[model samples]
Each structure stands twice: as structure tokens, then as C-alpha cells.
Target: MDYHNPNYATSLYHFIPSPLFLGKQIAPNAFQTTPKLHILDLSGNAGCLPEHPELSSMPELQELYLRRMQISVFPAEIMSLKQLRTLDLSQNSLQHIPQGVKDMTSLTQLDLSDNNISALPPELGMLEPSLQVLKLDGNPLRSIRRTILDRGTKAILKYLKERVAED
Candidate 1:
């Protein structure tokens, strides 16, 4: 795909299939030309993203799907997107949620399921104001009990908030 074309300059959505890159790192310049993207789905591309993807170029991005990307660490670059409402990082290799997640104040939905996460950051509780949907299923969480996890997002947020208050 010719990313530099004028037609794609104002495009608000883009989906790059995994087969196209064959697990190779996506070029840093791939999304540099499309700054207005609101929704970008680069799912199923294992290790296609660098540790810190150059997503700062898309300030208007609202929903980003990076499922099954084999990412072990949280992509700190996403913290710059204050307009982001939904972020899907499920099915990755993430081991923990970072404190920087509190910076994503606009996120209403966050998916971290099917990962190796063992605990939820207390800072995540701060997002309770805007975050409505939090998926932690298929994880091996030890910090939060099963009851809270089963009670759903609200309960999980409450638990985390209490933990934050304790510290």
C-alpha cells in the first residue's frame, strides 16, 4: 500500500494484515503519513510492532487493536494518546500493566486478556473515572482474587482503588 498517497492523507482507519509483513517489524514510516487515523487494527501480527511503536504520529487515534502481537512489555508510546478511548492489547505476552496507564485518561475500554499478567497496577484504579471495560480474563492474576475478577470491571476497579488507598 502506498501510504504517501494524498488519498490516504485524511484516512481515519487502516488495517494491516499479518500475512503482509510475515511477522517482520512494521516500518516506522508506515503510519507516519496518516495522522488522522481514529481506528487502526494491526492485530495478529506477532512481534510486528517495535517495543515502542511510533504511534505518537496519530494523535487522533481513538481505538487501537494490537491483539496477538506477542508483546511482552507495555508499549509506553501509547501513553501519549490522550484521545484514545479503546485499546486492545489482548492475546499478547504482557506480564504486567504499567503505572503509565493512568495517563490514558480517555480510555473507556482496555483489553488485556489471554496474557501472562500476574497483577494489576494500583494506578489502573485511577482510570476508573473513564475506563468502563477492563478485560483481565485468561490471565494468571494473583493480586486480585477470583471473586473480584468475576464481579466484572466495576468490582475490579473498586478493588484496585482500595489497594491504591492502602498504599
Candidate 2:
């Protein structure tokens, strides 16, 4: 499942190498035989992926990729891992993030670009405490005034404060 290898190349649209153990779900007892893993790629498997508790048991998991998985709702269970610092949910069908997502304070980088998010909850700014970079480039939001974006991210930060503070 490690496509990050320096020599990796592919002609197919999408694929990951084997023996790295990529699946929709890893049965509870399945991971006991393997050493603790650092990276887990679950991209494109959310639909068929079983809602298993074991998915979050990897104590050393740092990076998670779940792009284009058609998951509309956020998985709150993954937020419990204090070790996770990066999360990618690009190109999914997510329109709204569950409230519990604010609990993932360990995240330094988060990608939610190209989803169907029309409006982000005010709580999303709470991520700023640890969030260094956030991507919301392609969404159907109809209210971003040109002046706001032109004003730079300060405008967005102010907007998030006003919107979430009201909640």
C-alpha cells in the first residue's frame, strides 16, 4: 500500500502495491500478527469498508488518505487517535463534517478540497490551534465575495470567528 516509494510508477488510473495490507477493513484479530503500522491509506474504500473499531487501533498511525471514497459523513472514531497529524478527504461526497471532527486537535494538515461542502460549520476554525494548512479550494459555496478572498485569509479567519462565535 506504499505508493510513496521513490521508484514507484503506474500506467493504471489508480493502484497500490500489495503486501502492505490495503483493505476496506482489517478484522479485529487481523492486525495482531503485524507490527504497529505508521501509515494507512483507505482512499476509495469507504463505501465497502466495514465500520470496524480496529481501524483506529493502530497507535502509531500518522497519515491517513481517504480521498474520493464517497463518504458523506465524517468518521468520529478516527478522531480519538492522538498520534494522527495528517488527514486527506479530498474528492469525497462530504457535504457536512460531523461536529466531533473538531476534536481532532492533533491534526496539523487537513484536506477537504473538491467535496460538496456548501458551507463550513463555524467550529471548523477550531482546527486553527493545530491546523497549519487547510484546503477548501473547490466546493459549491455561493457566498465567497471576491473582496473577501482578495483580502486574503485574514478575511476568512474573521468570517470563521463571526460565524462560529454565533453558535
Candidate 2 local lDDT, 1-167, one digit each (tens): 45575333221122232544444454555433322555666676645445554545565667778887777776666777677888898998888777667777888888888998887666666766577767777877655665664564446546665777887
Instruction: Encode model 1's per-residue lDDT on 109-138: one tens digit a residue.
Output: 999999999988998998986899999889
**How far off is model 1, as Cα RMSD?**
2.1
Cα displacement (angstroms), candidate 1, residue 69, comes to 0.9
lDDT of 1 at 40: 82
The Cα local distance difference test for each model comes to 0.86, 0.65
Worst 10 residues of 2 by lDDT: 8-17
Best by lDDT: 1
Clashing pairs in 2: none
TM-score per model over all chains: 0.90, 0.71
Q: Which stretches of candidate 1 lie over 4 Å from their true place?
A: 1-4, 10-12
